[model samples]
Target: MPVVTTPPFTISSHETPTGLLRVSLSGEFDMSVGDALSRALVDAARRPGVTRVIVDLEHTRLIDSHAVAGLVAGYEAAAAVGRGFTVVNGGGLVQQVLDVTGLSEVLCEQP
Candidate 1:
């Protein structure tokens, strides 16, 4: 007998009084979940008084190229509006992928 497992991916968000929106993303980031995330980010960025956006990926299990592209696109869109965008709590494999793809520099990272 064999067992199959499903990848986990979810996005939750909230806003701060300072107009910074924080979105916490968990689980695998693949083509299956890219569009959902893209839509969420786009909507958040378009909201009034959203001067900054932070994507917390501390619990993210995996991220594929499609997800990476989505992130880049989201970052660019936020930048176009003069809004701050950042990715935080990514380490280990996730960090490596971002570094190899040269997206680490393009996307802001928390200290």
Candidate 2:
């Protein structure tokens, strides 16, 4: 699949050197993208050897509460299966959301 998705938002995934599933998100993150984000995370978390999942949001330009909710849902789904989940590489609006919601230190720890 293409690295940048066509609708909702762009999503790309790969295995990190540390064997973690790294999902990169870009473009607009809103109510429309919420369900898609959850589905993507679910797929990533279930991959073999994917003991951990990292959502890299460095390129994400915008986000809404529903998108954040999807992130939380993704976290919960990963946790349920003993798979670790974290949002990373956040900046700008992405970082702001994580901070405003007090998830900066919880879901993300990027500087």
RMSD of each: 6.3, 2.2
Task: Give the lDDT of residue 35 in candidate 1.
Answer: 82
State every prediction's TM-score relative to the real structure: 0.87, 0.86
Best by TM-score: 1
lDDT of 2 by residue, 1-111 (tens): 136587657999889667688899988889877788778877787777789998989889988898888788878888888998998888887788888998777788555
Mind giving the per-residue lDDT tens digits that candidate 1 earns over 12-47?
A: 888889998988878888998788777777666767
Which ten contiguous residues of candidate 2 have the minimum total lDDT? Answer: 1-10
lDDT of each: 0.79, 0.82
